[model samples]
Target: METKKLLKAAAGAMIVAFAISACQTKKTATGQNADPAHNSMNSVDWAGTYQGTLPCADCPGIRYTITLKDDDTYVLKTRYLEKGDSVFTESGTFAWDENGGKITLADRGEKFQVGENKLFHLDMEGNRITGSLAEHYVLTKMTDQITDRYWKLIEVGGQAVADGSTQKEPYIQLNSEGNRVEATGGCNGMGGTYELKEPNRISFSQLIGTLMACENMEVENGLKRALESADSYHVQGDTLQLFRARMAPLAKFVAKGK
Candidate 1:
């Protein structure tokens, strides 16, 4: 009986040991953990495109454009400038490093140093870069701010322009450098500056228009009032809607892109 009990106890011990070892990280020939088991997903709030001209060994340059998505997926587009306009794209899931300062591409044995609005390419061994062209390895983040260009008025408070109206087309363009706007009030051409007082609030300033007397004065005056009263602005697709405080949009414009 004692021999049987001892044998049973030994088997149980061996089973538990095997289970524990299975739960541990995978080991390589050198007995080191090969797979990074650290889940550093919460390391950075990075999600956007990073683009730069990376130095190449054989080719003239590699135009690298990498976009990181919110779902932890990434799309890498590489363009060989010297080779041709041909672009090679690769996409896969990525994980953050144990130190939370880097990201490792699971599919391609590659890594990158994540920084504020930038990324630094790393080597195969996941080590520091030591090269004369290391400075050019950095990629800059793309801006999300509204482009500084003219947007023609497409609508006003849910009203689109009537067909065959003798009144001229209305428009508004914000100055990129300053808080200024150049616009046309139905018939008269005008220009003014704008001030952003809040995260979603804006106000027009010193709006002056051509003093031409015309039959379309009604349409022009209405547009002028809307601009002066606008307290906020929202952009959707190619359309821009300027709004008054606590009310619907006072004016709307669409970008006539080049």
Candidate 2:
């Protein structure tokens, strides 16, 4: 009877030890504690501009540049080396693969594997490279956001803004300090505070404009409506595009200074 009691106690102690060890075990990709979820990538993680000098069959090389915006849209710019000054540009949407480790261009179905500040040119079959030229197929990221500068209103709802040929053009200045937004509301002097809610999300509030109504009231009204409706923004090269909640751009601005 005493031996039986001892056996029970020993079994209880063994169970306790096992439980403690299990509690300390960390989950790994192949471990018993691993999670079933896979392929998690947010907009900020996948959005950026990537560039590389890709090999070409006819030309010396192709300077490949692709801008990945948070809106799932992408712009592909390519320049043929030793060919001409002509630049080929294409813009469309992109989708992530099942693993989230790759993105497929919607227009051409080309696949690119995502990595740390790099994108690998993958085969159409969406597999990793195993050849001598594998190293050269990688593109490095140039940064996703642009620096703050004086941005002049260039386009309003897809129409090109006049270059002050007749009237003075509208302009805006975004100060890095305190999220202040100052601009010419096409006809009046405007000032406001902006909120950068996220990498892609932005909001403007407390906007006030002068009452000195100018001749171009239509332009002024358009600018005010666009600014108030803007909920997101994207900076591509020298251009800044303001968008309103899942819709097309409300306004587009270009940096005036070098």
lDDT of each: 0.73, 0.75
Deviation of model 1 at 91, angstroms: 37
Candidate 2 residue spans exceeding 4 A from truth: 1-40, 144-258
Q: Which regions in candidate 1 have their CA more than 4 angstroms from the true location? A: 1-147, 163-167
Clashes in each model (backbone N, CA, C under 3 Å)?
3, 0
- In TM-score terms, candidate 2 sits at 0.46
TM-score of 1: 0.44
Model 2 Cα lDDT, one tens digit per residue, 126-191? 876768878878888876443246788877776777776224568777653445888885667899
For model 2, the local distance difference test gives: 0.75
Q: Using TM-score as the measure, which candidate wins?
A: 2
Give the 10-residue window scoring lowest on summed lDDT in candidate 1. 30-39
